[model samples]
Target: MFLGTGGMTPGHQLAERDDRKTAWAWYRGRAVRDLANGYTMKRVYR
Candidate 1:
């Protein structure tokens, strides 16, 4: 869905995607991976 990026700055608030929690979770995981390493993703269980 071409999600945008986020940071301590403004103009990027992802929390608005409350209707698509799965998309938000995946996006969050990717963002976390971008900031760190060794991120292993399993099928979403929640």
Candidate 2:
């Protein structure tokens, strides 16, 4: 979650364009892999 948020945070914009692309790609890939492995979150409303 933090990786996804960090990828889009304002501070990310300060990075070089190439670095931003690489970071975003890495973050996205990690998310996809996790989902493929069945990692999930369930929300509980109380």
lDDT of each: 0.57, 0.68
Instruction: List model 2 lDDT by residue over 1-46, tens digit each.
Output: 1256755766555566668789999999999988866644423322
Top candidate (TM-score): 2
TM-score of each: 0.38, 0.50
In candidate 1 the C-alpha lDDT for residue 18 amounts to: 54
Candidate 1 regions with alpha-carbon error over 4 angstroms:
1-19, 37-46
TM-score of 1: 0.38
Q: What is the lDDT of residue 40 in candidate 2?
A: 40
Per-residue lDDT of candidate 1, residues 1-46 (tens digit): 3354645224334444454787879999998886665333233332
Q: Every model's Cα RMSD, please?
A: 13.5, 13.3
